[model samples]
Structures are given as structure tokens and as C-alpha cells.
Target: MNPTDAPFVPGVPAEHQPATGSAPGTPLALYFHHVHPDVRHYTALTPREFAEGMERVLAEFDPYRPDDLLAPSGPVRPDRPTVLVTFDDGYRDNLVHARPILRELGVRAVFFVCTGLLGQHSGQPREDYLTWDACDRLAEDGHLIAAHTRTHPHLDRLPPEQAQDEARASLADIAARYGPGPARLFAYPYGGIPAEPGLPGDVLAFGTVRSPAEPWHSAPQAIRRTYLPSGATGTWDGLVRHWRAQWQPAGATARPDDRDDLRGERP
Candidate 1:
């Protein structure tokens, strides 16, 4: 049988459910970064490993297109559960291994890139990062390409002016190369955020910490994310354990209608 057709085990709830009498539409968002099979070592995968990982994800959640979440005027569905897949650091492994699997599964995801790091020769031990041409292809294939800062700087540690520069410069770089502008979506390097009091309002920032039970919080432009690491036991019991530990409240049903708002909210 195909791995994609494997049965999924339901995980425990990851967030807080609404009060019994409360109205529906409570938001719940789950975010994922890299999706490799073997993360014990940061090595690129052979084609077979990538295929297995893609099968695991498709069996679990509904992957969404970046544009669908950023659309300005659409009747957002409030009941569907949304899982946003994101790749950090412009890894070439994403284009080589992850992209093809995603295409086979018909999943759409977002790729957060560091412009200065692309096309540069890196001695980082892993040739898993993406190339400029690969990035262009992913974008052309309808995947969302957003900013991860100019050089992957930790925004929280920088001075106010420097933080703003990092944020703006990354955005500008993406716009110059990819087209009009990165949709309001932005991911902070090392999951960092600005401490500056007057940060720009144009972009939306997504953080690294996230859960499944509650919807993400709104900001001038900020959203929280759940990290799905590689090597997580892909069993039904394992998934349930992760979900319950991460987001689900006791005795609560997740409403599908709430998922629309959850996805649209920043991050």
C-alpha cells in the first residue's frame, strides 16, 4: 500500500478550547518548518527519504497555500483546520528533496529565505540550502516566499535602528528579486523579534513557539508557530501525544470554522 494512504492516529489537543457556552470560531493554527526524515544529522536526503516524510504530513493535516491565507477579500472558512508549512534558511535540500515530495502530495507551503545567504558559498557542512534559481522556481510553482531577515540576524538582540534595518532590508531584497512584495508574512531569524517600541506596521511577524489548542495572537504584525521537528515518531499515538501536550484542552472539540480565522491571523 502507498504510504500516503496510511492511517493517521489522532493526537491530543494542543491548545485551550472555548467555554462550553461560548460561540464557535475560536482560532487554532499549527506551523511547521523543515520536514526531513532524519534530523539526527543535518544532512540532505536521498529521494526515497523525502518521499516518506511527505507521506507522513499529508496523512495528518490540510496543507494550505500562502496566497489563500493572505488573500485580502475572500470568504474565509472558519471551520477548516489549517497547517502552514514553512522552510527556514533557504536550504537547497528544500528544493532538491522537500519540494518534489510536496508536489507529489499536492501540498502548498511557505519558504522563508535569507537573501544575503543565497548563492553564497557556505562552509556550513550541509549543502542542504536552496539556490537563487531554486528559490525562483519554488516561487513560480505557487509556493510563498517570505523574509527571514537579510543575514539571519537575531532581531531581539539588535538595537532598535538595526532591527528595523534588518527587517526592512530583508523585505526589500525579496521584493527586488521575486516581484512586488512578500505578503505580510515574515519569520524572525532564530525566532527573534524586535524590542523597539515603534516597529513598522506593514509586515507581520511570526514567532517560533506555537500550540494547537488556541488560535494565534494578533499583533501590529505577529503570529506564533508550532515547530514540527524531524524524527518525531509518526505513529497515531505519538501524534495524539504531541497534540494533547501541545494544544488540546480537556474535553473539547475543535471546530473547523475556527480554522479560517486561525490561518488568516498573523503567523
Candidate 2:
């Protein structure tokens, strides 16, 4: 079936429409980190507004965690488009304003949190970050809790040893707080870190800035994401356009004969 003609999957939302003119095998993914009534002004959404947005999302897309949706999980399917929702910074607005909406929609997401920022003054008035109890509640609700490092530092700028420490310690803290299971996901601060050579085995997925060309071929750890802004042009239609543009071919599709050459010894 043509990419555009593919029927929308049940439980997946419409705002995640595939790119116009895309063919089968084209890779596509959608991402969102924050959702507020007005992001230009960095304000939280009112309960009613949040409810409306969730209702819209629930009608169209399957919200997934990075590991389950991305990675060496095989080639992309045009009809079965997968959208992953992620929230960075573990803000209280997530627990206060976003969680209820997500729960209402029955969509699960991953929250990348800075453990060090947890019980400290938020610098912003009104308890901006999520409390430990709130984080626990989110996890209990089936949302994945992942790391954004301990202090939200720029790991790329840090000394190599310090960077390693940050990565390890942050994962440790997240495991401790959320219970000792495998910790698989991570998000870099400000999208600054490169994929390291020897990350801990527990880490499964990491996030990076979205690149349209080669959208799905980044470092195994570097999953790409599009930022969702809130505004007049930032309506649900705007979100669909942004995702569609990213689905455009980064380069010519591989010819069937080239598959062997591309595989080489990688497999």
C-alpha cells in the first residue's frame, strides 16, 4: 500500500500522519518532550486544555518508549508508524499537568529525570520539578522512568572521567529510586552528548536532536526527536507537518541488490 494510503492504526492518533508522498519502508517517528497550553511563554496548561490535547492524542497515535519503538528492531513499516513520547527534566508540571492527561489517554511515555534536581529548590517558583513521590507514582502508572543524568550537566563538555561518572551515577540513582530493574533509556542535557564507546550494559536508548536525512540511522543510542512548540502555528496540524517533513527520504532508498553490500559484516 502507498504510505499515504495506509490505514491509521487503532490506538494511534491522527496528528502523527505520515509524510506526504512517502513510500513503504520510509522511516518515521514522532517525539514530544513538553506539552503545555503555551510554551512560547513557558507556561503550564490548564487542566481543561490538557484534557483536550490528551483526547486528541489518544484518538490517533501509539505512544511508546524509545527502546520498544526504536533501535535494531528492524526496518520501519509505513502503515505501522510508531510514535514515542518523552518528557525531559522531570518537572512537577509533568506530574501536575501532564500525567493526568497521559493517564486519561492511556498512553505511556518515558520521563528522563535529573536525579540531583529532585529534592532541591527548583530556582523557579512553585515547585517546578517532580517530587520523589510523584516520580514513584508515574512509574507505578506504567510510565518508564529514565535518566537525564544526576545534575543535568553538559556531559560532552565534561572531562571524560566525569562524563562517565555522570552517566553511571545517574543510572544508579534512577534504578534506586524506581526499583532495581534494568535501566535502558537516557536523554542528554541540551542534546549535547555524543554516543560513548563503552556505556553501561543497562542503558538501552539515548536521545539526540532530530535529523531528517538519516533520521533512523544515527548511532544506535542516538534516537532522534522533533521538538513540539506551543502556539498558533503549533497546533496539531503543525505537529503533523513537522513529522511528515522528517519522513522525507534522507537519500535515495537502497536498491534491493545493494542490501548485501550494505549489510557487509555488520550482522
Candidate 3:
């Protein structure tokens, strides 16, 4: 199916709308960047807002860790809401600002990090980036520590060979350092086209936004996410709209009578 096309909207009678709390056919994987309040970058979400979102989501949906969903496990609980939390770029604030609230709520998220940015030898330090120690702490606390790449770059913009190399090297380095389990999960920097021409077949890569996974999900490399940005989603209401509602339909069939529950958040 074309990722750019509309999501698989079941042909339940057009009048038969799914309730806000009804289980989605698949989990809604939510991705985020910085979670600090003081840094008002367009993508950053304030701590208080994030905490509030987590509380609401936890209350409404069952948390599904990346590994659980990637396992192709059967009997996906369609009786209740399911959500997968993921973060890109591995900012130190993931450990500093986001972790505490997640830890308290018992929600284990996946943090995809750039391997090159963690150490002194890698080059000049970006204090805002995460350290290996911090990732280890995140893992120790039950979060999935995945790879984003050795350095954060738009993979689609790189030469095919270079893109493949970046993907492979990061996977290898992450496995060497953190072991192979979590390394199975990869997230593209900038959520560039999720597929690199030559990355390993086994790598389960993720992209920024592609409709939430449909039931019977099997394509790990093209896993879709609903990215959360404080700029687009207010701290509280935005969380409810995103985590609780699906994007409004956009195909030829989308009627003028359809409610605008959610607008396009991705560029």
C-alpha cells in the first residue's frame, strides 16, 4: 500500500463512527523530540504538558513497548486502546525531563539515539545530546534504547551507499555497545523516507507520520508514527485529540459533513 495514500478506513457504514475510547485496529505509536518546557523550540513539549499527556494516555490506553509489537505477536488486544511511545534524536532531556514522569507512570518508551553524539572522541560535545550513560539508565529503567544513526542526518538526502552505511554502522555499533536486542529497532533522523535502499532486511525502522498501524501489522521497516510537537498540540488538549482521536479523513470520500477532529500536523 502507498504510505502517502489514505489510511485503511474500514467500510463500516459512514454513519457508524468509532467511539473515542474504542480500540483502534492497531496501536497508535506516538513520537516526540525534546520534552522540556524551558526550551521553546517548535518541537519541544513542556514538562508539565507532557506529564499531563502521559497521565491521560495511560488512563485511556494500554502501553505496548516496541518489542512487543515488533514480535508480530498474535491476539492483539483490540478490546482496548494500545499506544507505543517513541522519541527521536535522544536528547539528554529524554532522561532529564521526560523519564521521571514516564517512570512514575510506568510507561516504558523507546528512545532512538545517534551513536556518534554520545562520546568525546565522536567530536565536539553537544551537552544537550544524550550520553551513553544516560541511555543505559533509560534501559535500566525499562525503556527501549534504539538507534537513530551514528550522526543525525536526513538519510533520504544522502547518497544511497552512504545512507546504507549510516544505517548499518549505527546498528552494528549499537549492538556492540548495548547488545542486539534493542538494536532491532531503528528510527530515521528527521523521519526521512523510512526506507533506505540498502539497509538490512531485519532492521525495524520507523518514520514520522504514516497513518497509525492497521490491524495485522507486519512491515517493521515502514512502521508509522503520530509525532507529537508542543507547537502543534497544546500541552493538554492536543494530547487528548492526538492520543484519543484519529486524523480526519482526506480522500475523495471525505465529506463536508465530517467533523474536523484533527488537522494535518505533519509538513
Report residue 237 deviation for candidate 1 (angstroms).
4.6
Model 2: lDDT equals 0.54
lDDT of 3 by residue, 1-267 (tens): 222332222332232211221123456677878787676653577888788767776776678655563343222333335678888877877887899989888788988888887643322212478878888898888888888888888888998888878888888878887777777778887667634446665566777553234322354466567644454443334344444544232242324342221111212
Worst 10 residues of 3 by lDDT: 258-267
In model 1, where is the ten-residue run with the lowest total lDDT?
15-24
Q: What is the TM-score of each predicted model, taking all chains together?
A: 0.70, 0.67, 0.73
Candidate 2 per-residue C-alpha lDDT over 167-265 given as tens digits, one digit per residue, 9 for 90 to 100: 778788887776544255677776666445246643444444432223333343555554333332235553444444334435535344322211112
Which candidate number would show the highest lDDT if scored against the true structure? Answer: 3
For model 1, residues 135-183, the per-residue Cα lDDT tens digits are: 8899888888888887887788888888878777878777777754464
lDDT of each: 0.55, 0.54, 0.63
RMSD of 2: 8.0
Residue 110 C-alpha lDDT in model 2: 81
| Candidates in descending TM-score order | 3, 1, 2
